[model samples]
Target chain A: MSAPEELTVDVNGFQTRVWRKGSGPVLGFIAGYGGLPRWVPFLDHLAERRTVIVPSLPGFPGGERGHTVLDSHLDWIVAVRTLMEKSGLVGADLAGSSVGASMAAEMAAVWPADVRRLALIAPLGLYDETDPPADPWAQRADDVPGLMCADPEVWKALKAPPEGANSIEWPIEQVRANEAAARIFWPMGNTQLAKRLPRIAAPTLLLWGEHDRVMPRSYAARIGALLGGRHETRVIGGAGHLAELDRPREAADAILSWTS
Target chain B: MKLMWFHLMPYTELPDDFRQRHPSVWVDIHSELFDPKRAHLMYNDFMDELEYAADCGFDAICVNEHHSNGYGLMPSPNLIASSLARRTTNTALCVMGNSLALYNPPTRVAEEFAMIDVISGGRLIAGFPVGTPMDTCYAYGQNPSMLRQRYLEAHDLVMRAWQEKETFAFNGRFNQQRYVNIWPRPIQQPHPPVWVPGGGSVETWRWCAEMEYVYCYLSYYGYKAGRATMDGFWNEMARLGKDRNPYRAGFLQFVGVGESRQHALDLYSEAAEYFYGRCLHVDPKWATPPGYTSEGSQRAGIESQVKQAADSIVRGKSTGERMAATARDMKGIVDNGYVIIGSPDEVAEQLREVAVTLNVGHLMLLLQFGNMNKEVCRFNTKLFADKVKPLLSGLFSEWEDRWWPKPMEDNLRAEIPAFLPKLAAE
Candidate 1:
């Protein structure tokens, strides 16, 4: 019902802002390319029974100001692992979307003992030559909203420029986030996570939206199979890449059923 | 004033429907659009134009680096600079310059520049650019956030390598070398004078000012579009208590010279259209990769102003309204000061105004642009050299240009005759 309180946390050397709420079992959520928008009803729904922690990935809007020199995906996994450990998130449930989803899988594979459950929404790092994912960096700024969401209203709402911010401040914020995303996912998002997908001992949940054109269903299926046993796949209807924002009820129900 | 003839060496023969069918002229544009047969002639002619400019008595001839683009065919400017060093004898070599961060050790840049300096008998004005986002971030797949950091580190390494006489170890964030020695040190003491070419970034203005390096504004939009940027640099220089010597800055402008103003316009209108319409049809997305603008720069709000100004000009709107690049006709280009098309006197007068207004002592002339043929390019270069240059050469004679090449005096500046005269004896 209320907006989550924001907390600034320093992991190792870098710092990031995290949004947290609820009081039950700890759950860590890594943001996607569009980042954690102002509103997310599913975050509230999940917060009903579980404590949720969302850290802004570096280079995005509210993340640490000056740390974008990640040499490889392994460096990113190590950084995220350090953050989780620093945040006291031992054996907790971890969820990620898009670039974040791929990072979550990496954390699960690399530090299995620290993560009990893994949930990926429109996850990346899995490449399908026949059915490849859309490049967020290549798409025109005007075409971004439509490509991101299936619903026209949501698309229109997202495309509208922010109010109160000056012209320079507006694009500056967007470019910062985009720069961070590009650093991690440019050229291609594949970190060869498929090789380590089977190493993820935690129970995995793969969620894909029916209208999610960016990361198609083929990727979800491939990730599901690569993850081997103790994994489940759920396809949500009438939603795009951001199922939690589009069909929050359906997304919440799936997460609740699995975690409960 | 010091005059340098700069060439983008554009792939001039793009299909008429290139803008309509292609998403961009850079980065991801299909390679099928490029035909090697056509490129053979273009490259040779481009080189001929640069050589002809040198022969026409231009003080320096310039070349630069770009990648995977139809706009500039010189991915490795050193190759062209090297070839030009052999062909020309007197003119200073302004290799304005190689992309430092792209090299692995970055000593490669130092070594190549040293070789060029040695070959040219010490005539090399080294230009260190952060490079455009499309070149570094997308085409080369460098991380946008770390690119500047990498560039800075590479710069430190390159400068130190060129200056240090003895072998030393360099442990940098981007590169680590056990033996940091480079052979064939530059002829210019403590290395050649460094010139930094940048699009209007506030950070660059500050950096160039602090380093005391010549700050060059290389915008395709020309003198009018560059007013704010040049003003910002001068203001920064004053803030730092640096001298207001006009020699501290260089500005690039498109120039077309003919027998008369009307004839000049008629000669260059199609060429200007080809350049503005097709050569610069870059997708906005490719141009600005996120994090390309640093958080500090973004916060400072300078990048925004530059972007807005550029966008307005592109849209043909009079936002800041000084010079609209979106007014994409020959007349608009001429009127907006994007291109100076006129007779010798008319062109010289406008150039004098530009020099005085911008306070630039080193002026880089883009005389041959777009699809202008070899004959036209040579004619433009010669006319400017013979007519316009002499008038404006005395404008900034008060200040010394420390950024210019210090070529050996003993070596004769061997001049090639413009054309052989027929024998008079019968």
Candidate 2:
């Protein structure tokens, strides 16, 4: 697998960066907090059959400047719509992780026509009063990777410093991304997406990690019931909140098989 | 130079294991810890101390707003200021001040401040603070990103409402009022001398310098911790081509005065320990929500010791290490200048140095802090007012303090009658 080409797409006059790869149908992938890392082998694996489109969420690493104007989750949804429209992703497959998963769910709900199908991995929009999702923002930086993944190796790999010699850039990017995320999901991540979930008409897939520390298994039931239209559920046994990173091959295979 | 007495009115009776047991003293700290009966006595005693400060020839008495906190009991400084306005004669009522953004219609600030000013016979120094993250973002659930914008808009609206003679409309980003007229405008011609209390944000320094308002650094960490911030403020002022008038800045210092240096140390140690150790054991996360500090300020790396302490906590350092880093111990707190405790002459000398070093004309002294009893607070107030105040009063005599309250007259400094001298001679 070859490295993906990084490109910038203008959405509503804001410059957003997207990593483009592969040759077939468009699969728009939204990123979680801290934006997407420079290296993700999973994107290369998925790119063999389908063209994977990974856009940095407005306030994340590569797109920090562009995301400043987006303050609310609604603004984020608008930006995602713009991303789809500008990227020529009409009726394309959509997928996201954690905060990104919440965004994907929102886009599918609000503009069902724009997304042909939706895959949400450990989404964060709906809240269960009895067992709320672990707050990523409140967790210590050292404790973050462990919360994101059950596998210690995966956690260590994810936490490895940015490859660039500029050591400060990585943490700075994290701060920018965290600040951006806080704008939308600070005190709590609930965007009242439960009320709007019934509006989604597209086929949906809800994926959960059994050992997910951030978003527990209890969330699958809540999200599954709230989502509208034909849907399927999958629980990856050994993964954590970020199941894709922990079980990349399984996550990608599930996504590909579902899309096919 | 003007001397003001400030009180946090701390609820000083937290358990010894509060640091171990409670998550924080502010924001998420449990409500059951606050006892109403204790609060009642605290308020009465606190008010009596403020009244005493007024009687003892202080220029002003200061109160500020904090929410969901064991430390700093005043959620509404304006209410306390209102109560103080009637009881004290001639002392400027410095409600430093109502948090503008928290109010639905910020004109409530204008109206209430005006009311206090009128009641105090034109002695109102209006203080506008953007407020702490614990108070504004976490406790109030305000969007950290929009907080500053909202604060700026509210400040503008309040200023216009106070100044504009005609009943006009205010179309603000955060607030909209068709008929923007506040009843009972302040006694001072233009709005009261507006002082902005800040915690070393570069933007705040620029804003204060730009607006020509007094940049009051409410440093709970004391003069040593505040040197960099105050210097930065001066440098910003210089950069903006503003005058280096000492009165344009104010610094908050916690001072304990006694008959001797050792005596002062003995008297204030327990109270200082309670304050530095117990009252400030806040959860690191509660202290800083992202976007609360501006990117510019964050990059500038301007912060207080409290924020640094919170950072250490978040990094998950051992308790002893974190406490050491926070200067929670009596020795560290005193050595770091968090509290200045000494004999009258010693405290006065140190304060003079602080005034000269910070180049501040207004010295707002926290004579009462932590769990210090009412009698001790009263003693500290009297000793400082009688001995320490006279030493520093003439330091900045040349510069005009435009921010000081415009009292109708100096009733407190009234002349002793001619007959009294004749009676004394007879």
Per-residue CA lDDT of candidate 2, range A1-260, in tens?
56788888886676778888998998978776656656577677778779998887777866755566775667778887787777666789988888888888888888878788888888887777799887776654567778888886786675567566455455556667777777777677788988998988888888888799887788888877877788888998898888888888888888888887
Off by over 4 Å in 1: A12-15, A37-39, A69-72, A128-130, A152-171, B300-325, B411-426
| lDDT (10s digit) by residue, model 1, range B70-125 | 87999999999988888887899998888889888799999999999988888899
| Residue B162 CA displacement from its true place in model 1, Å | 0.9
Error of 1 at B166 (Å): 2.4
Return the lDDT, model 2, position B255: 93
> For every model shown, what is its TM-score relative to the native structure?
0.92, 0.92
Best by lDDT: 2
Off by over 4 Å in 2: A151-161, A165-169, B302-324, B409-426
Alpha-carbon shift of residue A207 in model 1 (angstroms): 0.7
lDDT of each: 0.79, 0.81
Considering only chain B, report the TM-score of each candidate against the true chain B: 0.92, 0.91
* lDDT of model 2 at position B252: 96
